[model samples]
Target chain A: MSSYHLDHLQHLESEAIHVMREVAGEFERPALLFSGGKDSICLLRLAEKAFRPAEIPMPFLNIETGHEFPELIDFRDRRAKQLGAKLIIRTVDDAIARGFATPKPGIVSRNQLQTPVLLGAIEEFKFDCCIGGARRDEEKARAKERFFSFRDSFGQWDPKNQRPEIWNLYNARLNQGENMRVFPLSNWTEMDVWEYIKKEQLEVPTIYFSHERDCFRRGGQWLPVPPAHTGATTPDPYAGARPTEKEPVKRLVVRVRTIADMISTGMIESKVHSFDDIITEISAARVTERGSRADDKASEAAMEDRKKAGYF
Target chain B: MSATISHSRPPVSHPVDILRFNTCGSVDDGKSTLIGRLLYDSKSLMEDQIEALERSADITGGGQINLANLTDGLRAEREQGITIDVAYRYFATPRRKFIIADTPGHVQYTRNMVTGASAANLSIVLIDARLGVIEQSRRHTCIASLLRIPHLVVAVNKMDLVDWSEERFIEICDQFNEFLPRLDIKDVKFIPMSALNGDNLVDPSVHTPWYVGPTLLGHLETVHIGSDYNLNGFRFPVQWVNRPNNPTDRQLHDFRGFSGQIAGGIVRVGQKVMALPGGQTSTVKEIWTLDGPLPEAFCPQSVTLVLEHDIDISRGNMIIGLDQLPGTGMDLHAQVCWMHQRPLQRGKKYFLKHTSNTVQAMVTEIDHRINMATLVPEPAPAELVLNDIGEIRIRTAKPLVYDGYATNRLTGSFILIEQGTNATVAAGMLLPSEQLVRPESGDYVI
Candidate 1:
């Protein structure tokens, strides 16, 4: 006997690492989607393993929502600087100014704003593939996505029309002006990610850990530090049904469950502050991470619809 | 974390606790409704997903939250009241995470079942109570066994439709029991439930007081999947050559290493290993994980292995233990399940995708067709058609390093590609035969 136990994590890592190397071997110019989230952090580490003892040659690309948590921005910059790797930030705000993307007037969400920014970045960088940390277990629409998801020049994804990839071979063959989205962590689960972060001892943004923050109520749940801008709702600007004139704006101490753009993701009352606490809380919690994603919460096929529109 | 798996659980839970499993059974088996119950009862569902279920509940006879719609997400599926394609759904619990691939029950989508079960460690084969044991159910079990899923959960759904009759459940179980001995299956658990009313899903129902097994969720969480992975033999297919091309980077200037994930076994530093095809030998210099140096890197792990010698190895070639070096040959006799619409004719060329390598392959001979439904040998079949399981002789343009599927799934199983269109035509599990019967011939196809 080899005397080694069945190492599922190691197995998942190799699967991901093999995929990362595939991206490097197959594509001409590849970039990784780095959002400073735990999943992206795991992706960063896998990239390191893919080409360790050497620097990650691929650049870390980010579609800055403009409504990013300030803490995440600082961490993103610092980490990129530490790795000595290229950091490409394409802002949705800039795209909005360029007429590439336009949200409804006075809309709070900058999420829909990310698509044009991402596509614009792909165009500017001429990247053939953009590696992302999208796990299939995250959502139904995401589950239907292939490992080597493709996009047209216009950056549209037609789920009905996708090429079949067999065996371990990914046919990254694309025509001119076409690009691919590679998700190495597609097979991994949420718990797998936290485990990897701990094993690798990766330095992630602090928002992942539970922390006290001022919040209001929304949709029978809490919202930590609600965005100053409001979405297209009037009955209750945010904190749900209010009294005739106004109810006291009580900002209660709350912690975010999933840290998306402030406009989309909501918060919960969780004292589980550290990674350990978060794991425990998640273990007992009945809801999935995306339950709070305003966009996902909006429609059953919202994620899928967004994906078809080049929103990874 | 559960005490049983914690020591094995990688402390850093790879950011997702998602476990992907598949359910293979025909229509009316309540595949969708079962998934609906799991999601609804587990409380992993959101209010909106539930509301969507309610709004379109009329798709089924009654306007209830037709549980099947939970997985049957497509509008076409709702309209036809059938799962046409491979439908995937996501649900999670603190103990673990899950993604279910609800494959269509129709025989036409057998290829989809292959696609679903390829990456899955477990296969949940649901059988309707009214139809105790049918051809579709048998075919599913055969495919699951063929795919080498370590664990099998047989959910006898629609027990309510059968009046929660233990006799019906027992009869189906008895029918399935007859065929178990012919195949290699470790764990098989039978659970009877009514997906409509959500019985024996997340919680055991009071009616089934006679039944004393874990609930569906309980079994899903506690299944002994630790020993399910292929960790016995070491198999590493080099996916890339990691070389930093920066001239200013002196430390990385001369670093040329074969980078790939460890497919099967552990590779320890200074451990003697051999490269296949060329048959060259070398010792492991360093096993590199994402962080830095590691004492060893094992199967299913993605790590770069640096050999002490500059042995010629590249993508598609594998590294294995010197003692457990795999057989190398151009001709292989494998138990293949033909998945193409066109029948698999002898002497026809196709692309064979094995591990990270894709090479030209031709079906040299068709030994016999094993009827997936009957589970019997049609030894004299001239051709294998869609969803047909049979032993076929395949000759590759180049040598392939492989092991028996029973021994190492990662190394044993391979897919056939249609030569002209490059479509994946078939999937095969190898059986030891022919050349292995003779010593020095260097010819084996299974």
Candidate 2:
């Protein structure tokens, strides 16, 4: 009948839920790479719709850069506990402490430092698959990413040699030490994520909504002022770089377009307070969501390079 | 003034459906420029993305700002000036959302084209107006027909170079009409446009006053895609068995439901259905979705169905409506697109994953490989190499319930997984079954 049609949001939801179920049916060990962002929040809801009533048959993994917004970290913990899912937090600080990473001078953001920590966790837990929330519309390199992106034993993505994914059938076959980075939201856009969140009434981190925060301008982008305490033992995420007098601190009403390390995530000035406002804002957005991500601005192929080095 | 007010609101103010399509053309055919023109003219390009394109030094062709750099994202692709992999681009109008699978067009990348065109509802085959119907155009059209894309648009690109000639466009259409009947495609439209100069892309061009038709964007926004799904025979390949068994919740404590995406037809509560391989019949007690319970479910909707009786249906079982039953047999004949470098031959075993079921299958015979150049069957090919399209027969260890690929793409399609590498070796389409009746032991529970 004519009423059998599913709206765009419903279609995207069904497609994502099918992908999540495929991982559950196929893999021996799979983990959802939770970042407490809107995309992963949508992923959690899709997972619930996929394998609910029965517990989600996978753990939640978070690679903390030690510079994460406290609100996001809190939300991540609460959501995982509410679902009764296991939350595994592997920090870049821990990787540095274990001598697996040496921090480069003047590089404040631990975004790139997250790769080794993530790879180490995969090796430690022997997770055959890690489901991520990466979308094709986010970045250039990510646009070409397959649903079941294969990584070598070294956790490297060889873009040119990606397996051809056809139909709804995916080739999830892998050898030992190798694993898959599954993106159920590969076809979803930023607007789609917000729309699904609105349709499903899924709660995201408070940082996603506009709020007053201490910030300063750098590289023509807003950066949050790390708290004074800023974790006593670990090195200050804002060590080498601090806002000078030329770049004065301003209390701007800002909200994050993408959730990453507080040090590298840029804040856009907006008055979006609800999902409706967020959807409206993203619809008219002239720049991409990743445009606010300071880490990707380092090099044109930064995401691709880090992805090849096993970054989620 | 009302139009201006409506424009301020987002295009998705109301419920809109999605359309997935791919653009196919060879090198120097302006495939990327065509995509760039569409995105640019449709106002889908972001401000920062355009700035990046302007800043990049890969500009070519008289400094008109190479729009292809927007899609050719990889470093090697930028250096080599070609698309190496499938890049998905999304854009939306007031009417519908679009998912463009920008596939590469080299002969060596036939597998990529097949992969991109698999889930596409329509395909745009770009033809160089100067060159007319080339080898890549025929190859792509043949692949689109093989993949069973519902619609095809032969975009006669670079009309500016040809002085906007209507005869040139008609000649290209005639060339395609010669081989189109051999293909399975039903709907085809010919558009004359210059993607480089933004002619007849989103808006109609003044130069083509003699030629009257809907612009490319107008056609994409209003294409009839509502009947694209198969809605005749009910087919549900169970993907997972949902049993919440929550002690706290009484409703979910004893719930035993079969969860899957409906592959075909419409299923309703209180309808009599049959399970395949064992041929047991049961009544549909309820249909559950994430939102709530529904009276009926149609093709492509994922839902959990509860049966009236306690049946032994698990993750690889098929639940079907009694009216139009699917084929049940262990021997299969199908067309396959071999993907791996290792050539396919007889006696090689594989893990055949059809629907949600996977069974051990062996190749019985290689019927013929379709020659793309001539669109003819080269009989009894010794082996099907990588990116080769061929017909083959297979014998599976267990019986599968399925339909013909022409009838239903979801239920009738399968992939062969190589054992050791776990590499997907082939994408298959099952042929129509001769026996459509019930199986030998028809134990009706009614």
Candidate 3:
């Protein structure tokens, strides 16, 4: 007999899958929030389970900060093609070149620059809802977020005017120029994501498998040495972006299981080499996956603050 | 294994053993601190998080990490040192992962607790050993029973303060056991523990050697929640009508599928299902997951089902297995936990949100309001006051396909949405159809 009840795991999965299908069925044009991270990967698998036999239905929407790892571009395309889902790349570079997104000098992180790019893509495609794999347990600010998070025309999440999600029933209704940021995996814990990945044998980026890479230490976090966080004098090709140096570099044997943009994803000094070894290390680990995420390590409600600023 | 019998084992296998439960009780009962002890002792705390805890130690609350802050994060809540919102925390053992809904114990936040406990399979009610079982404990436990939580655990916390007295523990245990039968809870496990000293959380303490029960976390990790789902019946509520209207694409253009997450049972391709509201029988032709085709799709898997016959169906319509069908009626009898500041009075109309369907409903009658202290009915009061748990009859505009909350959680529960603000004010668990009374608001004035 199949040892399956709609318990927490199944319940979370069901809710996510259901929400994913609702997006496909309800909206004319929709896109996914892909960051080449664990949460987005989990969202990819769920999207796969949601629209299987056909395709993921929607296209991959990446709000490129122009600061992402070069390897992510390859991994993102490879997986998108593997599932035959459409890949839609909208970059902060385009936003800055078109005067949509702007960035300040001496700042290497394009985390804040992605908002205009995202909002531009939404307006371009007239996307009604953007499906993301954000979990409420990831941070405290997220703890207060609604599943069907509302975003205005400017793509700002007004937490005070959030809709209520009662009894697994979601109100996905929206008006024109307004969009819903649906988090199907809102109820899932980080542990549930890993276990589901393992159980489903889902493929993720190789960087997540404890890969060895060249990194330099800055403020206790590892940056990919030279090219990363390079304070620039002139305008970058991707418009309005200028990589700046904060301090002198200190090289280390750094490895980050989860990869974000090269400028922000903090690398940990881990010697664990294989997926099996990583799992073992994670089993006894006390810190959260986002702990090493240099971007989130900035403030207490960093994830929340970014999310409210329309950063999925 | 037989060793893992859950609350009233249903002899069925649930997909995953992982359980999401809530811990709710009054402030002094140490709900937050006890939960912190559970996670800390279970070794679920991450290195970075622990470090942060060490760095940002509570200044006003004794310079120690206010364990409650781990779950409670709202600014108003932190400033007042009270949990005003539902905070979720997750942890895992090699066997299973657990997510806890650490809800507020304040009277004004019963809605938050109800929201958290809505998805919970089991509920852990914490009680202060010195205070015994209080009103909050009874209210939460009663709601747990009403919500059809299969299992319950009552941690007699602060045992250290009470000197680990076995007699005192037994007396409270007996008091709980006496009321458990009345609340309709199928299973209960009692344990004595001190959250501050970390007794019987991860390891059974030597001080409480008289207690042979598993530690709080031990019971949580091993307790079977495998049979709590409604696998016998099949109910699917259509969330939306999937019609890919790309006229250029010949194959995709005409596809009309009623998409939804199956709420119960296994639906195989070619199986017959009776559509609700219209009672039309259709055969399943395809099951589309985000990935692709499936031979069989069961409850909780959000799969878009394609039926052979293109019958009339839309959102809010439910499709059920022809074999084990559900009861359809306009009158719903349910036990509701009043959450709003305004009392639930007779002759009032409220929005009833059941599953994916939302309809206007009027309270038919307030059968009885439960007296928490005595666990007895106060007959029929003038109104169902705030935090009042009572049975009520409701009438909706259209018929709804539902089962008893005891049978199917997805179909059997609903919320009362305030008509004015559209705020969800009450969470309800439906009783059987016969016991339900269709109250007419016109018959009685507020």
Candidate 4:
């Protein structure tokens, strides 16, 4: 008898593919939430595996913060085109302009504002399920999430009232106007994601690799210096007042551990360049991956609060 | 110089195989503390995490760095000092990675334990040495047995409280052995440890000089889980039919394949397979993966199998090997763990989701409910209340192809979703067809 076994990466891949295929089988109208981050990038690969010879039976959806890195947006668009899948983008800027969402004065982050926009997109498209890349190991609130997390008609997640998911038998049955946020990567940890990326040789934005860019120190972390003469002095839209004499900016070598909006995503000063380097850094790092995102650092339960409002 | 550099690096280069296990015990059995010690002693806890643990010590643990806080992530859980939900934690050593499903010990949250144990390869049933083998410990052990977990570790926790007496550990082990023969579990091991003081968790404890078994961490890394899955009977429930009609790509154009994660057994190219329910037989032309075509695929691998002939097959169909066919029936007898607050009454309809197939099913009869305290079946009750375990008969609208839960975990288990509320109300394990016939059938009144 021959023994058959899968390594950790292969096992995670198989589990993720199973989840993606379940979403494809159960839901009538489902969309993959592509954020162009490492997690979402892995989701695209899993989606391809789930449906392959056939185009993924769903479109790709992204709720943009509008302050996102140009490289990430470019990569997201290019990947969607390469897959020949339709990409639907709903922006927080558009939501604010249309009065559907109000930006908290002096708070430049559209992170909190993303909830309404995401819900709006769901309603407009009648997407019964939106596949996300949220991992349980990322945050405490996420650790409690079900693979097929239920959302009410108002797109609110009641953590205390989630349905019990057992084995691989997920209950994808939802009433009209109610939707589910499906996380195929629920079991994947940051190291697992990086390992899968290396094993699969998946493509991600170049920002993840080390590069020299004009950056400045704020909140004890590096922030990219916006291009000169773009007329935006402050990186954050709600950064109360323009610094008296623009906080000293310098060109520094940095890399991003995670890709979020420029105003919130922090840069790590490192010479690490390749996937192996990132993996080694993560294995020895002191802080959690989300620890770098200033948005999550705002409050202890920031992610939990946003999730309750249907933020992906 | 090269040899010195290579020797300094860890022996394993790529990612090691993962072991998923759950810890179940009453609130004070030190389940969370055991997990905390495992991570902390292994150097898995980050520096900042340690700092945060120290900072929150004053609020949650009265100035002592509480290890239980590592698994209890919810605010209410921390405030109440109890685990509320199943929190997953990850840690890795050089040999293997591990995913720990820290389930709450409260009896009301038995559904969480079932959910966690459903995917776990092994289950750790913690028992307090001072209170050797309590009712909660028995209940959790019975649940693990019912779930058919391959391995069970009876961690005799808090040995330090009992003066590290080998007699106490042996007594508890003998007590567990007395009732364990009634269950279906195999590969049971007992380890003595103090989760609070980190004795025998990751390192050898000086306190317990007589114990000879491997430490908890060592056992986890070395357990033989490679044969956990069934490899004889091939079963693939078609999740979706992949049909990418891209004109630009020749390879994708006019391609059709049945895609799903293989539930059991092995499938290879040119192997003759049959699609259940439809009874369509065809030869496997190729097994496709993201990388390319594979020569063969086995259980738990998600792959697309191309058939030699195009059949009228779609989602909810199972592809099986010709040798050992699964039982097909509309009437199924199963052991169900009721999860909802509302009692499971006879004649209530539900959406029975098994594998990728969902069918309308109604409870025909409730045979008996097992008393977790005694591990005995109490003859047919009025209805199964929340967290009640009982055997019941179900009649589905469509015939389902399945094996007994003891044979194949993926193909044999299902969940019942309430029709109106859409809440998953029960997790059910199907019994073999021979056991499906009710002994009371002859006593039925005309």
Of 1 and 2, the candidate ranking higher by TM-score: 2
Best by TM-score: 2
Residue lDDT tens for model 1, B23-79 = 888888888778877866666565545555665664454665566766765544656
Cα deviation at A197, candidate 2, in Å, is: 0.9
Docking class of 3: acceptable
Tell me, by lDDT, which candidate is best.
2
Q: What share of the true interface contacts does each candidate keep?
A: 0.32, 0.69, 0.46, 0.73
Native-referenced Cα lDDT, model 3? 0.74
Residue B108 in candidate 1, Cα distance off native in Å: 2.2
Which scores greater on DockQ, model 1 or model 2?
A: 2
Query: Candidate 1 falls in which docking quality class?
Result: acceptable
Per-prediction DockQ: 0.27, 0.65, 0.37, 0.62
Q: Which stretches of candidate 2 lie over 4 Å from their true place?
A: A230-235, B1-12, B58-64, B248-251, B437-446
Kindly report which residue pairs in candidate 2 clash with one another: A53-B244
Candidate 3 i-RMS: 6.3
Against the native chain B, each candidate's TM-score is 0.91, 0.94, 0.90, 0.94
Looking at model 1, residue A260 earns an lDDT score of 78
RMSD of each: 6.1, 3.1, 6.6, 4.7
TM-score of chain A of each: 0.90, 0.97, 0.87, 0.95
Measured with DockQ on alpha carbons, how good is candidate 1? 0.27
Clashes of each: 39, 1, 28, 5
